[model samples]
Target: MSQPNPSTTPFKAEQTFLAYNQTQAKAYVHGRPDYDRKLYDAVLQYHTSTNGQTDTVVDLGCGPGNVARALAPHFTHALGLDPSPGMVESARAQGGVSATSEPIRYELSTAEDFGCHLSPPVADHSVDLIVAANAAHWFDMDRFWATAARVLKPGGSVIVWTTGELRCHPDMPNCAAIQTALDHMQNTELMPYFNPGNILVRTRYAGLVLPWQLETPVPEFDQKTFVHRNWDVGEGFDNELPEVDLDRYETIMDTASMVTRWREAHPEKVGTEEDYVRRCRRTIERLLNEAGVEKGQEKIKGVMQGAMLILKRV
Candidate 1:
């Protein structure tokens, strides 16, 4: 049977992520940013020093195995788990990119139901670190935390992170007009289609309800071990590097989950899955041309605010 929709409220047992398919997976692989290497280094260092183990990592909601592959070198084994089979397939196809001795294995499983379906189930207190990159908002947090409590080794860590909305700054004439157009399109067209999970991301996950913080506190979890931080330096923080290329930025916009859903909902309206994307692209190019940004010379500096939540098992 097909998994239930994860979009619904109060998350039933049947709930599943159905929005992502092979096409979306391909777009995701191409458009998603490679998470900063510095973040991974710091997380690994902290995990090894605090937990005394760096042997295994389980990447939950691992779309295309990006995080798992990036981190495999530091661990003896890495597993990338996701609810979508198409995503898992894409991840496997993209394998062999890691320079590590360990290979990242991709599996079709949700964060809540992961260990239950494995042949040799993940043992209690076995996983050294658990991570969810740009995909934690969809989780049924209560169930996920319960699973984390069961699988995490003593002092093992859980690191969840997501990149937030983009803020554009173009170093061209009429910069204010360009920024205004971009903001209008994002706020008016794109924001309407975003799913409820986006609320968690917008709030930087600070408003998320953690199981350990529930009335009674989740057993086996250390309430005192939780930490959350917003790591994004904002738009003007990095000036040395060249700004985001407009073409690449457009491709990234196509990967938004809401855009995918909107495309599905309006198949007859356009040729592709993203009608708004076409419109936005056209609007951007038109505004750039009006502002005298020569063809193939348009660039805009932008930064996505990123947030992280770190926790440990007692």
Candidate 2:
């Protein structure tokens, strides 16, 4: 038989889904939530307050292009870059458009050197604002910062954010039990699937290297303007904050890259009692039963801690 295509391979250890096939991309697009308005406002206020232009915006590591779609209204031109071809295709199928009815473009590219090669040939130092929502931690910071310095105009800004571990809301019935179940589901059961990038996210990017920390420091970025912000659970960072039905919660958790890895690693267990998601549901359901949550009224809400880092180009 011909050698199996590497791109089609399953669960081979990778930094992060190196090849997000179409099915996986579609699942990601469906499962991920939009960033809350407060989150968007924080980024907008920082850039606008700093006199950053809004002509163009670039979203690096733009999985499924949600960030581009959400921020396109603020900029005349918006572009989303991701290394995965399946992700690019999945984004295009959304038909994302800007406030002026311009199409939001998604291109196949990596975070480190995306700006270096655009089909329309974006000029150096022309980009106004660059963002990487729930991304950035996976980037080669040295190359990414160098690329950011090259493409960002003077006073241009960059915003990056990521959500960390999820915790059950204290107000939920049998909340302690719920929390225990969630902790085991993520911290124990899924621990083996996590990669370095996932660990960076867990630390809320505190461990992420900045431009100045790199071996060859990129000096064009202004360290003085750098701002790091953290949001606790129920602080406008989580998607299903106040409440969400059990089904929606399942979908969101299933979208996690680690969950994908777990699924790939245990393909035979998928849809069975041994499946990670199924085990999670079983555990959560039993916990909910303690509170008499009714036969089918099961629901949950969580406080997911998150962090954001922002800096400006000199």
TM-score of each: 0.86, 0.91
1-314 in candidate 1: lDDT tens per residue? Answer: 12222333465332224456777688778887777667787678767877547778889988788788878877777888988877888889887432356567888888988657887877888898999987788887777888888888888888888776766544555667767887787677667666557656766776666766655457786667677877766332122243667677767777777766676678875554346777766666777778788887766666567788888888
Model 1, which residues run further than 4 Å from truth? 1-9, 12-19, 96-102, 170-175, 234-242, 271-274
Q: Model 2 over residues 1-314: C-alpha lDDT tens digits?
A: 12222222232233445588778888887777777888888888999999999988999888788889888999988999888888888888886777687999888877877755777766788899999988786676767788888889999998999998877888888999888767866766788777667777878888778888776788998888789999886568845557788778888888888888898889999878898887887788888988988768888867778999999998
Clashing pairs in 2: none
Winning model by lDDT: 2
Which residue segments of model 2 deviate by more than 4 Å? 1-16, 238-241
What's the TM for model 1?
0.86
